[model samples]
Each structure stands twice: as C-alpha cells, then as structure tokens.
Target chain A: MVNPLEIKVERNKHKKTKPPQDQLGFGVHFTDHMFVMDYAQEKGWYHPRIVPYQPIVLDPAAKVFHYGQTIFEGLKAYRTGDGRTLLFRPQKNIERMNRSNERLSVPQLDEALFLSALQQLIAADQDWIPSGAGTSLYIRPFVIATQPALGVSPSEHYQFIIIMSPVGAYYPEGINPVKIFVEAEYVRAVIGGVGEAKTAGNYAAGLKAQEAAKELGYSQVLWLDGVHRTYIEEVGSMNVFFKINGTVLTPALNGSILDGITRSSMIQLLKHLDIPIEERMISIEELYEAGRNGTLEEAFGTGTAAVISPIGELSWKGEKLVIQDGQTGELSKKLYDTLTGIQKGSLADPFGWMVEVSETPSGVL
Target chain B: MVNPLEIKVERNKHKKTKPPQDQLGFGVHFTDHMFVMDYAQEKGWYHPRIVPYQPIVLDPAAKVFHYGQTIFEGLKAYRTGDGRTLLFRPQKNIERMNRSNERLSVPQLDEALFLSALQQLIAADQDWIPSGAGTSLYIRPFVIATQPALGVSPSEHYQFIIIMSPVGAYYPEGINPVKIFVEAEYVRAVIGGVGEAKTAGNYAAGLKAQEAAKELGYSQVLWLDGVHRTYIEEVGSMNVFFKINGTVLTPALNGSILDGITRSSMIQLLKHLDIPIEERMISIEELYEAGRNGTLEEAFGTGTAAVISPIGELSWKGEKLVIQDGQTGELSKKLYDTLTGIQKGSLADPFGWMVEVSETPSGVL
Candidate 1:
C-alpha cells in the first residue's frame, strides 16, 4: 500500500481567553494549535496534523519515557514593525533537529516538509503571537521516541512536533545582566558525548547544577571542560561570548560544546562588520585575570531564545570577578540591539536571516 | 473526597504461551499483567492498577519525551524448587528508587505502598515465573516524567510503573568470558554527575560507544573516568571487579559510578567468606600492566540481571590485551554460583540477605 501523511485539521473548540499582559511569562501559556506528525518503521512519517493543544495520552512504557531518546530546538516567529509575522532562519532549527536526530538515532524528516508544517501551524495560531518589544511567539520544534519498550537501543517509532507559546520580554523590566557561577565540580558534557546535540539528557544533566546555582543566588551555571574541568564552555543553555580588548572572543566549537545557531550567526555578523573575532580555547583564569586588568570589556551568552544575554559577574570557587559591575556591557547591548532590530524588522535584514512565510510564500500575500 | 486509583483497563484477550526452557533469553518475553500508577501536581500518584502487558499510549509532548526526566530499577522474582516465589532484597530497589526520585526531582512513593502494589500485580500474574535453572521473572520498576511541556525543569507530575519479563540464564551455555573495548576517548559519567542514579540518560549516553564496540566484535565498552579519562569506572550496565594479586578490587563508589545492588551483595558475601576486597579508584594503565605481569588473574562485571559476568579480553587504542583467554575465571564462577544459589533458595541464608516472599511466607506445603 502506498502510504502518505494524512494532514488533518482539528481546530480548538474550548480555547481559553488570553492571559493578562502582566501574568504572561516564558512558556506558561501555549497557543491554540500545535503541529504533530508520527513515524513508524514501515509507514515512515504519517498523520501530519495541526490540532488543538490538548493532553497527549501515552503508554506508561514508552521508550522516550524510559530511555530519553529525544531532541528539541528553540526559535521564535517575529511580528514585524508593520505587523507582518515572519520567521528568523527557521531552517537552522530544522538542520539542528536533523543533526540531533542523527546523534540520538531517531528518524530524519525532510526539512522542507517540516518547515511547511510549521508555517501551517503558526499561521493557524498567528493571533497568539505577542507583538510588543522583545516579544514574539517562541516556537519549539522537537522529536521524541514514542515506542513502548524498556530497551537501551533506539526506538522503532517516533513523533515530531511543533508547539508554540507566546513569550514576553526575556527580562520583564529590560535587558539585564546576571551573574553565572563557573561550575568546577559539575561537568555538563564530555568528549564523545552528546554535547553538540540538542538532546534532552544534556538539559536534564544540568538541572541539579542549575538548581544549586539558583540557590547560591546566581542565574546560571557556566560549564567547563569535563576533562580537567578548567577550560570554559557554554553558560547553561546558551553559547558563551567574550569581548577582550575590542575583539570578539568566544570558545571554539569543540566536541564538548554546542555549535549554537545563534553563536554562528553572531560570528558571521561580526566578520561582516570587520571585527577581529577569534574562536579559541579561553580559560577561566585567563578571563578572570583579564577582567582584573580592566581588559575584559564584556561577556554574554547567545541562543535563539534569549538572543544575547549579558553576563556581568563570573563567580568562581569563592572568587567573584565582576566583568562590569553586574551590568549589561556596551558590546552586549550593541549586538542585542542589532540582532533584535533585524528580527523585529526595525532594521535592514542585511544577512537575509528573516523569511516571510505567511500565505503562499511571496505570491499569496 | 475519598481517593481511589482510577484505572481504565484494556485487556489483552490473546497471549502466546511461554516458550520452552531452552529458548528463553533475557528481556525477551513478558507476563500478562503489569502494574502502573500516574502522578500529577494536584492529584499526586493516582490511578494504580494491574493491567495487561501491551504497548502504552503517550502524549507527543510528555516531558520525558524531551527532558530525560526518567529513572528505573532492575529486580527479579524466583520460583523455588518447592514451588514458592522469593524476591531477594526488594527493599534495596525501593530505597534506590527513592534516591533516584530525589536526584531527578520526581516525587517519592511510600515503600510499603509500592511493595504492596508490586506484590499484588505479581500475585495476579504469578504463572509467568519460570522454575528452570537460573530462570526467573525479571521485574523492572521505573518512574518517568509524564508532564507535557517544552521547557527544561523538574517535571510537575510523573508515572511509576512495574513490568515483568521471564528470562533464562545469562550464561545458559556455560559461563564463557567476553571481550570488551576500553573507551578512553569517551566518558560515561563525571564527578558530581548522575552516575550514582540509575537514570536513563546515563544508559542513553553509552549507546553509540556500545554500538561501536559491538560492531568492532566486542560485547560491551569498559567505561573510564570523565575527568583524566584513565581511571576505570564501570562496565556498561554493570560494576567492574578486578582480582589482582589474590585481592578483589572494584572501583570506588564515586558520584560517577552507579551503586549496583549485586555488586554490594557480592562484596558482602566475599567479606563473609574472608576474601580480601577493596573499593578504590583503579587506573586502566595499572590494570594493563598487571595483566602483562600476571598480577591480574580475573575481571568481571556485576549487576542485578546478570549476577556476575566475566571479561576475558580488552581492545583499547589498537592494542588487544588477552585477559584470561576467554575462560570464565574461578572467582567469577564462585561469586556467580553463590549469588544465584542465595537468590534461588539453594544456599543457606547467611547475613539475612535474602527476604523470601513466596505465596505464603513462613508456610509449609
């Protein structure tokens, strides 16, 4: 039998009213529609649907519930200054998801098919996109193993889904700087591990350290090399960037750090701007000493969610090295402003990052 | 309002008969009934029941599908020669489950209630237990995050489940030693990581290496320390033990090595037998040198499923080291025989290790 995806439309019948502006936070309120597709070995991907966001019933013995064969990507759909909804390099998320699937040993889907499905779901839920400053519909596209088994190997069946939640400004007040603890005792990823993949285990492994850091009054935990535990890595969920003596410096994408899409874009943007940006292994001691000598200008983390989150203090083992008085640095703000400007359609899209995908590409609108 | 476990049972009207004694392999067949319970924030741990063993239905966005918020335990029940079932130290599994619950931030179930639930299910489907030599029904009790969301944190709700599968001897064809590849380039767990917990992420992280080793004609991978990458940590899914210079040594229970229930029981048995034993960090180079100089006589891995598994050779970095010429060593056989005898009710109950919970405890035929 020739099988294909049966694209179904199940609109929400009992959608709740939008939450008040003040109560809206990150990932708390989801949109009415969510995109979903299922995969089996013989049938491949089938039953692509945009259905009402509802409770998903699953077997208690599903493999993803037992073995963590799951991966996810985070991006956002922007409401342009002229009120047009656009996507920012959504193909990057698709590519990352495929890479992550390869690492997790899940099935790979056509990137174009995934993008089209995402467009359909977002269009159906466009009104849910917040339009204010630094606000957008945070899109989460993910894949998981749905087979019911207790084995350690890959699952035979899978599910790919796209869920959207309207998010407010990352920082409620304004763009703010926070301190991150340089975790020496705990390591996030190691060589030959799933450090580069956007898989679930990586985040789950970092939860305890994140909780401990929050208890210590820090916002995030900056991971170091698993071996030796000295070299700098990413900060919690985002890639780290540093500005030393008018040059953009970040840790090179080693086997143990995530090759973040935002980090790559920022590097490309810096290169285009004719900045001397170096991707090399920068140690914690070197950064701290540079900060002491008044040479470390700024440090920030780059990701699709927060864009560019400024780091003001590096709290090492009992040593507090303030990069810049617990405040957002000038370079951090400039990068954030340029990035958000392009995303929000206030500035020119020099890099061709934004793609208008609402109606039928360019013709239907 | 009074609370009762709300179960929607879907019975399996047809089930294949249990295979003959010779064909039964580990984790290959299941019983008729399985135990399940669900937990939510407002309704904590509801819906406990014994349902037919079948594939589970799941939500596409369940938190375990994306965050690896899952943990599990391995246990077994044996049918004694006089026709009574016995479970060896199930309390240990319960305690470990509680510890795992704390680490993953999942809720804990009362030990008494949990045991009663499992016993009820087992009693309901007790015919699946096999009475042949080294054959028993393996019990897998696990907890998973059943919440549906897209962000990373502790899951608000979870599910606790128990599934059983009948299995024959791990080494039914006589205990022959197996070769393993020593993995220095990869690290399974690091300091302050979730190595002590029997979490899915740990097993998931080891899959690629295990697959590579199996493809290279080895049975499993010998994991090393995440830091330094030289110290021996564990065998995949088992605890490593080395018989060096007539003294038994296993890797110390650092935060990165799981505290295997069988490993502990074997050590206690060895101590009772007046054999020398120590739990400390053992380096790979040291083991190689000892093997070369004839100081290392035997090596083995211990776990719940395979009570004791002997290792005969190790392939590392293009060097194939012949450990014991693929022969099951004397210590390995001795330890295995003792443990199996105790578990199967063939040996005397020394140190009060085995808690025989048959159909009627302390009753005669």
Candidate 2:
C-alpha cells in the first residue's frame, strides 16, 4: 500500500501563450501544471496527483475560508547558466514548512513525497523556468484545511498543493535600498503566538499597517515586538538584519520571529566570509543611538522573495534616520551577489545547497 | 438602473433531507438558499441574488487562501411565540462587519443592501427556522478575496455571501458555568492588530492556546493584554465582564478588544437595572485580590454564539479561584434570561432592538 503521486499531463487543446519575461511581475502568472494531494483523518494523505492548473472548488463552509487554518512556503527553481535547473536548499524549506504545519495543526507530508512532488512538477513544467538573468520559477507549496465545517477547531481534512510561477528579479531597480517606516502603532507578532509559523493570519494582521505605510511613502513597515513595541522584530514580511559597528546582528528567534531560510543562508555566508554575526534582541533605541554615533553602517531585510532588500531610510515617530547615506551597503551587495550566484549555478557548491531536479531517483520523474 | 436582489428558487429536483431538530449542531445544517454578491473595483458590488446553497469555486491562488484577507459577521434569526421571525439589532452587526471590512482592507458594503439580503434570504428559508426553545437560524455573512493572483495585497475582486444554519442552544445542560484557564503565556491579540475586527486570523491564533486549555480540563482560555500580559482582554472568542462587589466592569474598547454587540447590550441592560457598570482596564492582580477577599461576586462572557456564558472557576498559574462556589451567579442568570427573552419576543421590546423579517419592504422579498 505505497501511496505514491500519480502524474497526469494536461492535454493542451490550445497552446497557451507565455508571458514575456521582462513584463512578468512577482506572482501574476502561473505555469500550466500543479501538484495536489488530499488528507483525511482515517486514510491519512492519499490521491497525490498532478493536474491542469484550474479553479479549486470548495464548499463555502470550508475551514480554510472561515478559520484561517493554512500554511505556505515559497522557494524558486533557477535556470542555470547551462540548460539545467537548480534549487537552493529546497530541503530546508520543506523542514520549515513541516514546523509551520505543526503549529497550525495541519497534517504533515512525507519528506520524500514533498520533494518528489516539487521535482516532478518542475520537471513537467521545466520549460516554464525562465532563463532571463535573475529570473526563476517560484514554487509555492501550501496546505489548507478542506473540511466543510464552520467551527473554530482544527479541520480533520487538508489539501497540499504545489504551484509554479515564473517571476522577475525582486528588485526591478537592481539591488536597491527600500524606505521603511518604523511602526510604533502596530505590532506584527508577539511571543507565544503564531508568529514563528508561516501562516496566513500573521500576514493578514500586518496588512493594515503595511497599507498605511505604503501611503506614507515607505516601501515596507519595520515591525516592533508586540509586548514593549520597542524591540525590532521584522521588516514587512521578511526577517531583518542590522550591521552596526562591524557586526551583523539579527533579532534572536524569541518564538515570535520567523526562522527565514534566506536569513539563515545569509548568516552562514557571512560567517564563512569571517564577518562578525550575532543573533540577539536589538531595540529601536539602541539602533537610533548607533545611527546617531555613525555606527549604524548598514541595515537590510532577508526573505525568499527579496533575497537582500537594503534599508535606506527609517522614519520612526516623526524622526527620520538615514542609513549609510541612503545607499546599498557594501556587505549587502556582496552577500546578495554571492547567494544569487550560488542559486543560478554560476558559483562553486561549497555548502551543497543546490538540489537539481534530475538528481531525484528515476522512478519519480 | 436600480440594483435589486433577484430571487431564484431551488427546483429541488431531488428533495433535500432535513436533519433532526434534536440532533442539529452549531453549523452542521444549512438552509436551502444562500445570498451572494460580487464586487470589483470598477463595478463596485453587483449581481446581488439569492441562489441555491452549493460549493464555491475559486482559483487555488486566491488571496483569501494565502493571506487570510477575509472578514465575517455572525447573528441569529429567531422564530417568536406567535410564529414571527425576528432579528436582534442586526443593523449593528452590519455596521460592525463594515468596520471589520475596513480594517481588513476589504471593500465596504452598502448598509441597505446588506440588510435587504439578510431579510430576503431569511424570508426565502423561513420554514427552516427552528421553533425549539433556545434554537434559531444562525446567519453568517462573509467576504472573501476572489483574485487568482498570489500577492499580499488587497484583492481587486471579492465575493460576499450569506449562509444560515439552524443551531441548537449553546449549552444543552442549561445556562451553566464554564471553567476558564487564565492564559498568561499566550496572547490572542495586541493593540494595533486585527483583534477588534471579527476576522479569521485572530481566531486562528487562539486555536493552539484553546486546544491546550481544553486538554487541561478547562473549557476556555482567558487572554491577557498582548503588551503587559497583565490586563484581562477577552475570554475565548467572547468579550468578558467581571462583577466585583456590585460594580460591573469590562475591558475598555481599546483597539484590540472586539466591540461585541452582546457586550454592548449587556452594558446597556446593566445600566437600565441601576447596576453600576464601567468599561475600563481591569488587571488580573485586582481580580485575584477580589477572589481572595470574596468580593468577586460574578463573571461572564458575551458573544453571538453564547449570549451570556457564566464563569465558575478560573485556573491562573497554579491556583484555582472558584467564583460563587462553582455556581452560576445571580446577575449572570438574570442577564441571560432577559436577553434570551428579548431575542425570542417573549418580553416587551423597550429599546426596539428586534427587527422583524416580515416588516421589510415588499421589493426586497
């Protein structure tokens, strides 16, 4: 009784026109094929399959619609300098996604099954992987509660899906710095909440503040802790880092900050380069003091979407503070180049982070 | 052109079976007809109609599934003594729902249109309204983002739907007391978050703490303030109140505490009865002190689901503080009776809160 994924190719009666790579935005366009699986309490996960990209039909009372019981992960498949495709640390995303599943009470997937689904789906839609520089096929693996009940409890049924979208470089302006608003009025995540989990509710809670900040001419909102509203937590949807006095510092994962994959990779890369790095609580007051003393050399945000988003300005409580003369810091550029280089298969695989689609066992593809 | 709600009756080609009245649970049973409307940036809200209840079709990348950008409202339709259908101050729920819509970045609904939809839908399914004591048709109106793009932004398209279910009494064992665990470690919401709005994320964040409390033999978890973790915010999903030595008090409507309709009605009723009531911050330390001094006479929670849920025991940290010897307090019982009586049309309507479904204009029906 080995439950394996059954692949079904979409019969294209009409050939779909692919969008121009230069015109493509983040997640507006999707590939033709998608991976889907179901979970029930009695039979567990079953009926894994790849099907045509189409509308998902659900009962109106499904738990995902009413209770926000869903989790998701995002990574990318980069078309290498050669004809092959590469995935950076795909296994790490799967591991973190499982942790997110544990927190949201959604059922976890077998690691092999999860990896096989992604590899095969990417293999089937391999042509959709864009070859433009800094362009890649973004992979979204998410699980949603499918039970058609209107209760607040965890759902007994779930659906795991993997969808692909070809995306352009995150910074259309090319490794530019973004303006941030220090949100003293809104808190993103607090200790002992669903902050660590990559769930939808945490993102929903930040939308209001994000909208307001965008109106205020800021690209993102820098969130503070929920308790004191002083300690720095994150920047927009990404975990943040600060370079003060030759030290690379990020907020410690105090159960509220998300353990971002890109954040970890950047830290590893910085350590490998023999740069000082620390993960600890950094308050706004301390950061401002360092800025005043000219010790705040650089600040940036790290996430899958924007690998390294340098912070140029921070407006905190009507006080504007400029960082590094509003320029992308030297370290920020170096780290971004190194990581994206590794992702595009143009650099040596010292860390063995790149996983190729063809590397999976033959039976899956 | 006037945008009137078009009515479509289900043919019942196959007759539907109704669940037994005695076995009807909270949201398991649904009425035959449901109200639905669509919204777009250019067209506003259009295509208002009542259609047969069925599954909702959406793209897998819908914003509601990924970002939790959805809001909902809950109110009940009651069948009165003389076979009249009544809705208790439903306009208040609509107004609150609109506010929730605003906070969650959803489009605001037209008040008249919202009320008309409810009245017509309830009228169409009037026979489904349960006549059993303490039973009524639960109305749920929700808006979800229908856009297929996978970005964390306010959706361009939306769907608003109203579904009803005939539900039994919240407590089958009569209006008894429930044991509450004072959750010092977990926080449901913080100031400047979406706690006040009746959104899905706040409930999702509470499921874990609620599950832990239920496992520990507690019926609900009482959340503290997200900032200090000292002030009492809410009990489970309901707004909380405490009666200490004859003074009735509830947490002030800070941005985080939901402005519950039942809570407001209870406060009004208390004022009418000449019992002093105050909406201000009340600390747990003060509450425990009152318990130790025998001054904490009564406690209860208020919401649409449970009109008035009395609290009998509170387990905070290691100590168990039993209120009124683990029995329902006098005020709790009186308030429940008065509220339920008004809802059922068994009492004189002094404040003119109950709105009759048959009283609406003919064009709406």
Candidate 3:
C-alpha cells in the first residue's frame, strides 16, 4: 500500500475566473485542479497527484467505453462563516464508494488514500468553495476502467479521479415540493443487479423512464422494484421516504435500493428528534391507500444533490395524489432547515457529522 | 438525416507493422483508420468521417464516465479466398444498436448512414482483414455520451465510433467444448431493465459473478433470469441452446435477454436442415433431468465472437453433469462447420446473410 501522506502536487499555471455566486448552477463550473491516481494489475495504485484540471485522454477501446466498469460518489464541502471548510459525512461516501467498487469488480481503494486525496485536493482549491448562503463546492469522486481491451472480463487498468464544482442550492427559489410520476413501464434496478452500487448503469437505466415522466410534466420518476413492479424502489436517483399516519417509512436496505448517506442521516436525525420511523418493504398500492385515507402526511427524497426534496404530488395509473395539499410538509421543512443549518455550520452538529479541512498548505508532502 | 455518402477520410501518417497472423488475438490490435460521427441535440448527427486510430480526448466530467449512457454492436468481416471482404448480417446489428440507443435514451442513428459508415470504414482499411484460415476482422461499433456534465440524465451530445481488430479463431486448437458453471447467487438481468439493450451496465453487473465462476475453474457462467433464478437466460455473453431427444431448445425472446443475430441464424439454419427447434423457457432442473435420462444430446452457445461454442460440462448446485461424455457432440460440430463455412464463403449462402463491401476508394466524398 502506498503512503497517503506522500502525495505530489502540480499547480495549474493559468487559473480560471470563478463564476458569479448568484449564477453558480450545479456542476457547471469546475475548480482549477484535481486529484488522480492510476491502478494497474501488477503495480496496484500509483502516481497519486493533484494536477491541473483538464481533459483526459483515453483509447477508444478502453473497457469503460464498452463494459461500463465504473463507480462514483457525491458529497459537498461547505464554507463556514468563520472561513473554515467543512465536509459532512465524507467517510460514509468513501465507504460506499468502495462497496460500489466491489460490486463493479473494480479494485478496492485504500480508505486512507482516498480520504487524503480528497482533503488535499480540496485544500489546494479551497478558494473555489463558494461562501454564498446556499452554495458550496460539490465533490465528485469517480473510477473508470482504462484498459484498452475489448474483453468482457475485469479490466487490468483503472483511473481514480476527484473533481469539484461550485454550485448553488438545489432549490434556488427555496425548497418547493416536486411532482413525481410513479413509473410502471420501465425498471431502474432489481435486487440481484447493481442497484445498490453507485454505478453508472443504474442511472443510465432510469433515463428513459425519467424522460417519459418529464414529457408528462413530472419532475421525476418513482421507480418500482423490477421483480414485482409494485414495491417502491427509489425516486429518480434518490432514496424515498414517506410520513404515513404519524410514523415515517422508508424502504428497507434491500439489495436493490441504494444505501443513501443522506437517507441514513435522516433516519438518525428523526430518531434523535423522537419521531417514529420504519424501514421495510413498502408497496405503491399501500402508499396510495394511505393517501386515500389521509394518512400520507408527507413524502420526500433524500440524496446529496437535493438533500431533502419534498414530494408535493404523485401521479400513478392516471391518478393524482397530492400530499399536504401540494405543499411542503411541516416535518420536511424542519428536517431540511436542521440539516442545512448543520451543514453550513450555522447550527450545532450534534451527530458529529462534519469534518473540518486542515488549514496547512497541501502543495507538498 | 445526414447523407450516407458524405463521409470524409484522414489517413494515418505513420502505419505500424501488423502483428503476425498466428499471434492475432481477439480485439487486441486495431486497424489504421476508424469511423467517427458527432451527434448534438440541436444539430443532429454531423461531421461524419474516418480518421487515424488514436486516443479520444474527453472532459473529466463527460457523462459516459458517470451515467453510463452508452451502447455498442459487435460484428465481423471475413476475407474470402477470392480476396473479397464479407460482412455477416450488418443490417441486423445496426438495427439492434438503434434499439439499444432507444432503451438508453440516446439519439437514434439513421440506418443508411450507419451502414454507409461501416462500409466506408471497412473499405478504407480493407488490407487489415486477415486472409488466413479462421481469421477475420472484428468490428466494434459503439456510441457514448460526451456531454461534460455531472447530472443524472441523458446527454445532449454523443460520439459514434467504429473500430476494427483482426483476430484469429476463438479457440486456436479447433472447436473444443467448454465447461460452464450455473450461477445461483448472482442474477444477470430482469425484465423491465436494460438487459435487452447492448448497454455497458449490464455487462459490468455480470463481471463479479463471472470472476467468481472463473475462480472455480469454469469457462463461463450460465445466467438465470433475475426474477426467477431457475429459468436459464444466457451463458456468458452468448445465447445458449440445448438438444434433447433430437429437438433443439432455446429460450424465447424474453425482454431481459439479448436478441442475438447468431442465435437467430442458428434457428433458421436448423429449420432449413429439417431439424426440430423450439423457443421456450427451459429450467436448469429440467436440463439436469434430461442429462440423467440420457436424452441430452448437445449443448452450445451462439454469438459474434464465438459463432458456436459447444458446452461439454455443466456444474450447478454442487453437481456436475457431463454432456456427451465431456466431448463435442456430433450436431455441435456440424453446426459450427456449416456456419463458419457460410461465413468464410467456402459454402453457398442460402439465407443471403453476407453483405459484400463495394470496391471503391473512401478517402474523399
């Protein structure tokens, strides 16, 4: 194993002008530098460095282009009011990324090395972290197969990379509930497939269903389990939760549903708040029944991008079910405020979910 | 739609020495030139051309690396003793690729334009087609999302490319039967997923199971349907067929299984030979029962890479059932000889499966 502290750095000569804070959209503008490491079957991972952010060159026959052996993780770095940079639950994202690597048959990355790369890369480009009220630096860590072979077997070469983009809040106009269409035609993933992994193909599989929903004026598609086609799986790319009667219910960690970091955090936060929550299989029919009986108090999706995307309406089988009269629920508001407040360092991090970046210069090891 | 004949060509300045015919392996060495086209949401497909085989430059945030919005097709061009290049069922492959594009939410290519690109690319690099026995040029046509964005949606930009590699026989020592392991713990695909499409994620999802089967001294894994673990779906990357009581049985066109061209051709060839063939679901238990009853005659897989890969032994649930005494059956050998004969132009093409590339210079439009 390579030493995590022995990292090399190559500063970008020409720095890019940062975009205006008000115009910072999600994943549009990127920082000036990135972290990269190469993996070979015989040499393992080597040449870990932070270099200029630029286009990557790859052979057209790279296994990633054909076999899709790739995985990714998403997190954010918040710029505190005291000029400190903080990352929330980064270890959870790193652990989940390794699990995704195992599922995709890619080599496992050393957790220390992975964490060091993120810390150094963020430290090198700390000024790119937007200090706006609802803005931060969105971090994307990904791995791709780079072997220039067309075989179906696992690749012998890989590249791990981390890129950061400054972004505004998901809901720039304040958090409003979204209309979701319950998908019945296309499936995202099955229990035996790669749904649980943060892999590329799972997202690709949902594009068609999401597009169809979008054409019908729905913001997202609520995916159902591939086998039964009735059990709830996910909402677009997020883990879904619902408030039924007085208890919160989210789908259990079945092999097909993603173990979302935000979903876990929400569960912990609800428990800490003395609210009842259940993790079990939930069918769409049962959810609709709760809606008919006025027991479906609120519904929302949890992920890194949106954090807590409240669901205002759900359309399934030509029927529309509006939750909380097509408005955000009180509980969703409370959870969103508390979560964002902790993330931005405006409130106490009672769960100790934040990790502050070291201020030491990260240019040399 | 772009005109099929308006393709430009840029020849390579320095040509590398070709590998010896005996050392040629599958998809390891590429030809001198490759076909390329760009697709945009507003302008459609444009700038179709053939250029020197080289690495592709892509932004670090290209969607293909993150969302897996990609599709591909595999076919081969055989060089006849008369010095003519023959492509087997190219139209079918192009059609299937479009279906995959639809499933992955990618823009569809014009069939005529796709065929023209293939024909031109082959014509430009016709010298790369090996004329030795059991040697041909493997053609890989693929499309990848190229939009430099990190969102979980279909990409607005795409790149279509075709690369060629000269390859020798899949089994250099003649047609030897392979041992297959029946995978019980992992599933390949379920209906309502992207299984029917030739996308990257489906292949990535199977790598873990395939690697495990490899460690067990098996050549490939016999995949079961994701929903029902008992019904057989596919073997490795190919469609499987079994002969029992003098009748050939293969799985029907389930949505989770690929519609293989070689499988279709084999079905047609069997009917032409006055042999009975049935397309229906066959369970592993049923196949094992036939093995015990002395009715299992031959088993084989069909695909572009290995036209006919005969199965000698099957291991499942800690039980091994040897077929035809772990040797290639008589029918398997006959089918391989006939199909290869037709492909290489040594025999009559009864079904008109070969499409001969026109003898025209493809350097300029």
Regions of candidate 1 where Cα sits further than 4 Å from its true position: A1-22, A42-49, A171-174, A360-365, B1-25, B37-59, B169-174, B358-365
What is the TM-score (0 to 1) of chain A in model 1?
0.95
Q: What's model 1's interface RMSD, roughly to a tenth of an angstrom?
A: 2.4
Model 1 lDDT tens row, B53-134 = 7555555566776788888998989888887778878889999989987877788877876776666666666788899887
Docking quality class, candidate 1: acceptable
TM-score of chain A of each: 0.95, 0.97, 0.98
User: What TM-score does prediction 3 earn?
Assistant: 0.98
lDDT tens digits, residues B1-365, model 3?
Answer: 88876888898888878999988988889999999999999999999989999998999999999999999999999999898889999999999999999999999999998998999899888889999987899999999999998877899999999999999876544578988999998887888888899999999999998998889988889999888788999987899999999999999988999999999999999999999999999999999999999999999999999899899999998999999998989999999999999999999999999999876734443
Q: Order the candidates by DockQ, highest first.
A: 3, 2, 1
List the RMSD of every prediction in angstroms: 3.7, 2.0, 1.3
In the range A255-326, model 1's lDDT, one tens digit per residue, is 789989889999998888897899999898999889889989889999877788998888899899888787
Per-residue C-alpha lDDT of model 2 across residues A155-176, encoded as one tens digit per residue: 8999999988999866566578
Give the count of colliding residue pairs in each prediction. Answer: 6, 0, 0
| Candidate order (TM-score) | 3, 2, 1
RMSD of 3: 1.3
| lDDT, candidate 2, B87-202, per-residue tens | 99999999999999999889899888788888988887888899887788999999998888776778899999999899886654457898999998878888888889888888
lDDT of 2: 0.87
Clash count, predicted structure 1 = 6
